[model samples]
Target chain A: MNRLFVFCEGPDDIRFFEGVLKSELREGYASVELIAYAGMKHIRVDGFIRGIGAMGDDYLMVADIDSDRTVKAKKNRLKRWYRELDTDKVIIVIKEIEGWYLAGLNDHASRSLGLRPLPGTDRITKERFNRMIPDHYVSRIDLMIEIIKRYSIKVAREKNRSFRFFYWKCLE
Target chain B: MRIKQVSCRNFKSFSDLTVDLDEYNILIGTNAAGKTNFIRIFRFFRDIARHGLGNAISLQGGAEYIRNIRISSDVPTEIGIIFENELGVFSGVRDTRGGSHTLSFHQIEYRFSLQIEEGGYRILEDFLRISCSCTPDLGEGESGQGELRITHTEDGVFYELSTPEGIAIEITEIIPPYLQKNVPRSGTLLIENPLLVPMPGFQRFFAEIAIYDFDPRTPRKAIPLSGRSDLEEDGSNLAIVLKGILADPEKKRRLSNLMTELLPFVQDIDVRKFMDSSIYFTVTERYGDEHPLPSSVISDGTVNVINLICALYFDEKPFIVIEEPEKNVHPYLIARVVSMFGDAARNKQILITTHNPGVVRHADIEDILLISRDSAGYSIITKPARREEVRTFLKNEVGIEELYIQNLLGL
Candidate 1:
C-alpha cells in the first residue's frame, strides 16, 4: 500500500497536521504517518528526501517561516542544503504552526477556548500563542489538544494565507 | 528457555499491553513511562516461583502496588507469558496402549489473573496450555496432534490431556498429592507446586529470570564469604561472585581483559580478603605507580561497570533485565557497555532500560522498544523499526540517537 509520510518540525506542528490531514489524506493513501523532526536544523534534508524517494512513498515536509521573509526564500534556504529537494512538496506555515492552529477556530470555538476570535493569524508567534492561552488550561499541550478538537480546516484556510496555499497544493 | 512474548493487563501502569520480545531488547522511555514496572514483571514471576504468590505480592509492597491504580478492585490484574523451550525437557508422553511416544511442543503459554480482595489479592484464574506433536517411539514414526491444558477456576483446579487419537480424558489424578491438598485460594497453583506441573521446564525457567537494579554503593561494602555464587539483584554479592570468577584462571583472565578494555587505566581486577574473611573487589590501576584501589575507593561508575560485567557474563540466568546500565558510566564507554550487552544476548535473552542516547546510537533499531504514555497515562510500547518512517530515516544514515533526541521516534 502507498503510504504518506509527513515530516513536521515539532510536536505542535505534528498535532496540527494530525488534526488536519489524518482523515483527509486516507482517501488517496493507505495510511498517513507523521514524523516530528523537532527542529528544521536537525534534518538531513538531502538524505531524507532520497531515502523516502527510494521507498516510493509520498512525503510532505512542513516548516515554519521563522525569520525567512517569504515562502520562496524559505524554499531557497532548504534548497541550499539539498539542491534536489522538491520545493513543491514543502509546505511553509506562516509565522508558526500555532498560527495555523489559531486560524482554525471560528468565533464560537475561540470563545469556548477563552480567547478572542482571530480573523487572521499570519503574524502569530509561539510567544503570542502562549500569552493568549487562557488560565484554565493546565499546560500548552493541554490547550493544543482541546484546540485540535474544534479545529476547522475551512476556517483555517480562509484565515491564513500560507494555510490556504497548503490547502490548494497538498489537500485539494 | 526463552520468553517469546509477554502480556499484562491492569498490572501497574500497563492497563493492557502485549509485546513480542527478541533475543536482545533495549527499552527507552522517560521517567514514569512504566519501564521499571515492565522489568518488575519478570521479578514478580521469579519471586512467585521461588517464594510464593503471597510473598511475591508482599515483596512488591502489597496488593496496592500490584494492580493498576486506574483499574477498579473488581477487575483482575492479568499477566501471561509464552515461552520457547530450548532444552526439550518434556519430550515424551505415555500413550493409552502403554507405549512411549516422542511428544514435542513448539511453545508453552501460561497465564494467570489476580483479583484484589479486601485484605489482599486472590487468584481469579490460572491457565496453562501446550499444543504438541506426538510421534510413535516404535517403527515407522507417524506424527499425531495432541494438547494438554491445566486450568484453575472457582470450581477447582483441573487437568485435561487429549491423546494423539483426539480422545479427551481427565488427568486430574496425575497432579501430585501435595498439590491436591494445597489448591491455593489466595496463591497461584502453578507457582505453589511448579514441579507437579505437567511441563516442569517452566518452573526452572521462571525461577532463573534475574533482574538487576544495581546499587553501586552496596558492591563497595565488604561481603562475608558465602556460598552464593550468583550475582545478587542489587549486586550486594559482587565480591563473592567475583571470587568465583577469579578462581577459574581462564575466566579471571577474561574479566581482567574486559575491565582493562573498558577502563583504560585499570591494570587488573582482583579480590581482597580481610582478617574477618570478608572480601572486596580491588582495581589495580596502571596510572601513577600501580596500586590496588578497593571497591570503596573506586568510582561509582567503575563499580557499576564491574557489576554489569558480572551480571551479564557470570550469571547463569536464561533471561536478565538490567535497569539503567548507563547510570553512572562515562558517555565514551556507553557504546562499549551496550556492545557487551549485545554480546551477552547471543546466548541468553537480555533486556536493559536506559535514557542514554549513546545506548540508542549503538543499538540496532529492531532491538529498541520505545515506551511512551497515552493521554490517559497508560503505558504503550512500540518498535521504531516497525514504523516505515523510522526505517526511512535510519536508511538515510540518520542516527537513531538524533531521532531520539528530536523526539521523532514516538516519545
Candidate 2:
C-alpha cells in the first residue's frame, strides 16, 4: 500500500479527506496522513513538496482556489511558484474547499436542515451555515461532519465536475 | 584548507544535503532553516579534535540531538568530507599514551567519514592517497601513487595496506606500521597511526579548521589574566589578544589603518593594563578636543568590528567558520568587515552564516548558499543552478539580497 502524506489547506479540507476519502480509495491510500496548513497562503507549494519526494512515499498537496479565477489558473500560478516539482502531485479544489460539501448537499442529513442544495456548484462559504440550517443542533462544522457522514459520492460527482475530477485524480 | 565538498546524512537539520564550498562561502537563510546547524558540522569535528568522541557527543546534548529527528535511530548518523589534500603544509604533534610522535606527508585526497554507532560513535571509513605530483625527479618510489584505507566493519578497523590487513596488528618496518589496537571513538587519529604516516598532513588540516560564535557580552569583559593560546570561544582574553597585536608594530599599524578606513572617526586605539591588572582598549576620536573613549563607553559597532579584525587578521586557520559578523556593526562598517572577510579568503577558506542584507549584496551568487527548510524542517541548501530561469534572474540584475527577501531562491 502506498503511504499518502496529504497536506490540506485547512481543517475543512482535512475533514473532507478524513470523512470522504478515508473510504473512497481505501487500497490506494491505506495509510493516508493529513497535515493541516493555515490556508493556501501559508502553503509553500514548492519546498514543502520537494523535500518529501525522496522519502519514497507518495505526497499530495491540496489547496483551495480562491484568489485565482479558476482551478486551471491557480495550477498555472503554482507551476510558476514551484517551477520544477518531482514525484509530488498538486490538486487544487475549485472555488474553495467548502464547494466540496456542496457536492453532498442532496443527502438526507443535509436535507433535514430544509436548506436547498447550493446551485451551479458554487462554493458554500462558512457564512452559509448561519444563513441556512434553521434549528441547527450543533456547531457549523459538526453539521458539516453529519452532512459528510450521509454524503452521496454519486450525487456529489454529478453536481460538481471539479469534484469528480479531483476524486478521480487521487484514485488514479 | 579547501573543502571541495561535504556530504551529510542524518546530521542535525540536514537529512541529506551536500554543499560545495568556495574559498569565501557565504550562507544566507531565513530563520530556523538550520544554517547554524550546517556550520555545526565543522564545529562538531573541531570539538572531536579538541576533546574526544564521547565528550563532543555529550556536549551536543547526546547523539539524538545531533541526529536529525526525521531519521530513525537504526540508521547511523553519517558525516563525511572530501577535499583537495594540501598535505605538505601540515604541522601536527600526535600524542599517544606511549609517547608523542611527529610525521610528515604529501597526500593527494582524503575521504574521512564518521558514523554514530548504537553505543557512541566510531570512525567507520577513511581513504587517503599520495599525491601523483611525486615524480622520478624526486624519487623512483614517488613516481607512482600509494593508497591508504582504514575501514571499520563488523570485525574490526582494517588497515588495508598493512600485512595483517587490520589496525589491531602491527606491520613490518618496510611499511608504516599500526601502533594501537583501539578503535577511535571521536575521530580518526590518522596522524598518530603509523598506517597513515604518509597522510598525516591531511588530518592536520582537519584539526586546524576553526568555528566561532563570538559572544559580545561576558567573554568580551575583563577577566583575570590567563594565557590565551588563541581566541577563546566566548571572546575572553580579547584585551590580551589586542595587547599582543599591539606588541607587533606592523600588525598594529595595519589594524589602525584598517580601522581608519573602516571607522574614519577613530583616530587611534590604545591597549592599556590597569591598576586592577586587567587589560582594556580606548579609542581616540579624530574630531577636535574630544576625550578618548574607553572600550566600556565605546559603541558596540566599534568593539565588535575591532574584535573581528584582530581575530581574522592573525588567525592562520585555513578554514574559519564565523556566524553573523554583521551583528551591531555600523552599516558602513559592516561593508568594511565584509570586504576584509573577502580579502582574507585569498589565503584561507572562510564560511560565514549571515542574515545581513549588506553581506548578501556583497556575495557572488555562486558563493552564496541559500538555505531553506522543508515543511518537516530539514535544511535544503540551494546553489546557483544553470537553469534558464536562474540565468534570467542572474542577468536581470536582481541582487541576491532582494532575491532572498522575495524568497525566490528556490531550494
Q: Which candidate number would show the highest lDDT if scored against the true structure?
A: 1
What's the CA error at residue B36 for candidate 1, in Å? Answer: 1.3
Q: After aligning candidate 2 to the native by TM-score, how far in Å is the CA of B234 from where it should be? A: 3.2
Q: At residue B107, give the lDDT of candidate 1.
A: 72
**What clash pairs does model 2 have?**
B53-B186
Over A1-172, each residue of candidate 2 has an lDDT whose tens digit, in order, gives 5577787765467667877876665676557777653322223545556556666667777767777887667777666655544323777777677677767767464567555656546565555544664443213343555567578777777777777887687764
User: How high is the DockQ of candidate 2?
Assistant: 0.01
Report lDDT (CA) for all predictions. Answer: 0.79, 0.63
- Tens digit of per-residue lDDT, candidate 1, span B154-175: 6766777776664333354244
- For model 2, residues B117-176, the per-residue Cα lDDT tens digits are 665666555545443232222222222333445554445455543211111212232133
Model 1, docking class: incorrect
Interface RMSD of each: 18.9, 27.1
Runs in model 2 with CA error above 4 Å?
A1-172, B89-132, B138-144, B152-157, B161-175, B178-203, B288-290, B385-387
Per-model TM-score, in order, reads 0.67, 0.61
- The worst-scoring run of ten residues by lDDT in candidate 1 chain B lies at B166-175
The worst-scoring run of ten residues by lDDT in candidate 2 chain B lies at B162-171
- Report the poorest 10 consecutive residues by lDDT, candidate 1 chain A: A36-45
Interface RMSD of 2: 27.1
